[model samples]
Target: MSEIKHEVTKDPITGVETTGHVWDDTLQEFNNPLPAWWLWAFYGTIIFSIIYWIIYPSWPTGLAERGFLTGLSTIEFTSDKGEKVTTHWNTRALLAQEMQNDENELKRQKMVKEVAATPLADVVKDPTKSAFVLAYGKGIFGDYCAACHQSGGQGVIGNFPNLVDDSWLWGGDPADIETTIRKGRKGHMPAHKGTLSDEQITAAANYVLSLSGEKVDPELAAKGKEIFNTKGCSGCHTPAATGMKALGSANLTDKIWTQANVPGADSPEAKIEAVKKIIAGGIDREMPAWESRLSNDEIKVLVAYLKLLSQ
Candidate 1:
């Protein structure tokens, strides 16, 4: 085999050094140096990557228990039990530290404590407390109540009760609202299908609708009135059809419906059918208790917020 040789030369035309490589005995490769800026930029990236790896969690450790390389960075935060917790740097720990030190977060905590101690009536009267309740309570309501009552508290037609409306199954008083949030409510209307005939149920429904000023057959409504009083309906709803707040019975006099979608019905027949279906099937819905989930102060804020919304 012939010995391979390299010949380095300079081209007089461009005055650039040759790479000592030739092709086709004419074409020569130039030995050009890389730009200083490009070289520095490449080195800077390598340095940045090394620094990043040293400051944050990067490579996974071979040991399963150790997980990843935690790096040199650390975060300190006060735990709920008042213990100082120093852990490896993480987003959750960073947030906790921020919550403890943030100026706005500190102010919010102070306001929460102040609101918790104040009377519900006084809280509504005070401009500062009332404003806080409306602003802060909106977020709380959205987090918890909005899932059922909707974002604006308008409520779903048949699924949830409208908090924005004046009509309330339970009393709408501040104290009443507080109790409701703490204890929760279970609405129950026994099904009449087992005891009452189809005609009797229809008559009762028509009578119930008539109480709300809905036009119905006078003869059937009169018959229904008799059945309503005689049957157990009066026991919960009361004889006057004004409803008993203590029992969470719906007031028949008010046209606003909670369980039955009476307002949604287009035609008179559909309206009658809607009410009749409710009478036959009955209702069993519940508002879950928040006492365990939310703090007492949060419940108070929610009460004030809901009361304000209704107004």
Candidate 2:
């Protein structure tokens, strides 16, 4: 092996000093000192960082405390029990406090009062207020109603009511909708397995399908209709199969089957089973009361959106 050699040299063209090194026997690095301004700027950043660390909550000084070292701007005080506690000033906390100041808070309170005093019909007549109400309602729905009704109020079939459609288990009047949201609703359908025989249950399922104008076995539907009237189904669901709003019973005369899956043109069995299971086990649906959870103004905002959905 041969030893490699290095020496400081000058470039003939530029007359610049080299870094006493060469690459590929030709290329060399210039040996130049950094400019004073650049060096001072770099050093300034280091000094600033040190100062910032000392002035803010930066270092974890103790494992047991699970906290950072108290800095210059820290708020320190002794508790009622005489234990020392410290918290540092932060831009985020300052901004939050500023947001809750009297002027802004008063404005918000005024808006709430105005919305509450205004009737929903008149509220919707005003374009700006209507937009605010709808947006506010959508957010409230996402927070409270979305978990069960689903986002956008599409609702899961068989489990939750679909709000997109005009039909409603309870009346869809604006006041009714507001009442439902505030007080909530519970619908009870008694299990019929013990009350009716297997054959009657099958017939009842067929009769329910017939009410929806679906093609069902006429003879079975006839038998089911008779059983339906006698088995206390009409107590909630009226004789005409139009649900009673007072009881929150579902309407049977329409295509909407609350618990039925949307079956294709060929898959009628799936639709039948959906209704049959309900007859055997019954249907008990519940919507929680939001009176305590939400403000009256908030409920009105929700009603505004729900009315829009019905439209």
Candidate 3:
């Protein structure tokens, strides 16, 4: 029987070589050594992983009482002081205590007084003080007023007066505004939509515009004037179509719009919107009760801002 012998060759560095075998008539696989950089990187990773495992809470420890000893036994981490450090997190409680603490009482009271005494314009004029007041106001406003007043203090007209307007349905006194804000306010005006037709509404709207002293389209206002009396809108709006605060009926005669007034529609448009809102929603404006929601000091800040609006 004929014998076939295997061939071998020594590698240059590792001194290792593959069994003598060739494919595709010439191709051969070689045994090679890994580069120093690659070898070192691999070792480094292993060492880092070991260190990380030791320092951090990994395996469970039986000595749970001693921070480090318990942690080490349980494979948990402990501070240098040999105690387990725990995080402390709480909110509302801290705020409540901070707000009422004897020391805090004076600070909180002072903050409220400052807010009440300071006009909004003046408060805003200062970068530092205004920023604090604004942030403080925003939280209070959102927490208490956002439900009815909306995020931007924009209220539903006829239901809630928009705080943005120059013509305030109620007197725009700061203290008064604060009182109205803190305590819920309800305004009632007889809905005129039922009695007034589209035509009379149009006419009365025009006349109401004239009350604002702004020039109205003579033709429309003339029509509006007739409807104003015909619809008996004067019963509550008065002969002048001016508001009767007693009934919380807004004075239609003023130029300052209580709600969003469609520009060109003037009196007619404003009346249409007001009438529609009045009929659909009924006259109910509520400034939320802050007694439960806001601290006494927070309400004072609100009063301050409101006073600034009028001043």
lDDT (tens digit, per residue) of candidate 3 on 1-311: 33433456655566679556555544456756699999999999999877766654444456544333212222222343557534222244335444555686656567666765676667668666665666667777677666766767766643456665545665666656666657756665555566766666555555665777655578977887777676666777688777665555677756655543434355654545554454333465445566667656677776654443334
lDDT of each: 0.90, 0.79, 0.59
Model 3, 232: alpha-carbon shift in Å? 4.3
lDDT of 3: 0.59
TM-score of 2: 0.66
- What tens digits encode model 2's per-residue C-alpha lDDT throughout 1-311? 33444779988888989888876677688888899999999999999989988887678766525477645776544443557655576665455445445596657646666766788788778877777767767888899999999888878887898886878988998899888989999978888888888889889888998888888899999998998898888777999889999988889888886666634225566666778788888878899899999987778778877877666
Candidate 1 lDDT (Cα, whole model)?
Answer: 0.90
Ranked candidates (lDDT, high to low): 1, 2, 3
Backbone clash count for every predicted candidate, in the order shown: 0, 1, 12
Steric clash pairs (candidate 2):
158-259
Error of 1 at 306 (Å): 0.4
| Candidate 3 wrong stretches, greater than 4 Å | 1-109, 113-132, 154-160, 212-220, 226-232, 259-261, 264-282, 309-311
Candidate 1 vs. truth: CA RMSD? 2.9
Question: Top lDDT: which candidate number?
Answer: 1
